[model samples]
Target: MPFPIIRLDYMQISIEKLSHAYGSVEVLNDINLTFEPGEIAVIIGPSGCGKSTLLRLMGGLEEPSKGAAYIAGQAPEGSLNPLTYIFQDFALLPWRTVAGNISLVLEDHKLSKQQSKAIIDDVLARTNLSEFHDALPHQLSGGMKQRVAIARALAVSPAFLLMDEPLSALDSQTRELLMDDLVALWSREAFSACYVTHNLAEAVRLGHKVIVLSRRPGKVREVVEISIPLNERRERAAELEEVQQQLWHMMREEALAADRELADV
Candidate 1:
């Protein structure tokens, strides 16, 4: 019998000097970052700071007008599906059942029916949606609908997950509950995630490192490492609250400036 060998310390992603623009407007400016296997990184900034655009560039959904976006040491390739995204809107098909939506991506792949079913079942269980597989998107609660979207993403088993404010739509209580579920899943699954959010508390709670972006033509302002483990999170929430307060102070000025600029235009 042969034993399988595992290499744990892999460079899952690297983005170097990545910049993007639409016509005359620059959204991202010289963004440089990296992600290691099994790490979770959160990007935080005010609205229109290009956090979502950064994720799109990272996932190869959009091209950067300059610089580079790399996944697993290579430049973003059209055929390579290393990244999966979970959208804020849930993006579930209203007409499709949970299982049907989840299996939608897999249907294109040439997999045996049993293999696909097994993967779907496993992800459904992981996301705690096994009981709701028959439910349609319209029939699910906000959190449940997001869970279905997450399950759909996980079903592909990609090496990287790009999340764009995945929990922002839910109420505070529901968001907190789903955040715990997301952390649990991350710990178990070990995929690198880049989560974008404007929520300061969420950035502190879920990130291994949180990178703050400046206002439009977004540049990296700061990157803070969160040392607490998921299980020890609540105990340190007060300490984290202080850090969150500092972050808010920094973001508040920029936010107000952004508002004023928008009002002028």
Candidate 2:
């Protein structure tokens, strides 16, 4: 019998009393959350609720006006980097081939040519982009482009993956497929992740624990934990719809309040 392979090490992330402001305006407020290793904790809220801003803060790309984000732990068995972000834009260089785009990330690592080739090949195979390794961005479809982005991120072997509405730009069909692929990838790799999105369906489908935020000056509203395994989520879609609706109702109230704020002005 084949035992389930497990990676011993993992990263633990914590956000304590986190708050962010732009000049005089506050975007996030006292958002306290924690992501345990091997868990997919997704954050979702109404527009202007600073979902993306929180992700950036967690990645240490932006300085928080208050509180702090911490990432201090050992990575999984094969991972090397601390964290990696997968953006919605599929930020691939047009002039670079798929393999080259992946190689771009490894350039600063000072890896030998053979070492670079090995890493690129591994990620290409992981993302199912092996055949498109030499292809340019313009030649690939939207889904393929995102795959390359994911491959590039994977090549770095990040312990934590931060995604900001990564499937927002793709068509519906492509988005659905990618969602499934993402869950499968996470389940297999067991990397800690904090995915940010406004889509509740996406949240319910991908999150092991979903963190809901309130409107403007975002606050922690609720955290929903899904007990169903990843492989069972598709078959149990209807069962999960209630969780989706519950989140929608919570977010809708804030959305309406936002509309009221706009009207008051």
**Segments in model 2 whose C-alpha atoms lie over 4 Å from true places:** 1-8, 76-78, 259-265
> lDDT of each structure?
0.84, 0.87
lDDT of 2 by residue, 1-265 (tens): 4433343465778888899998877889998887877888989998778899999999989999999997656676656567899999999999999999999989988789999999999999998889998999999999999999999999988888999999989998999999988988977887778899888888999899999988888899999898888778989999889889988888899988876665211
> Residue by residue across 53-110, what tens digits does model 1's lDDT show?
9999988889899998875543233212458899999999888899999888889888
Alpha-carbon runs more than 4 Å astray in model 1: 1-11, 73-80, 263-265
On TM-score, the leading prediction is 2
Question: CA shift at 55, candidate 1, in angstroms?
Answer: 0.4
lDDT of model 2, residue 156:
89
Residue pairs whose backbone atoms clash in candidate 2: none
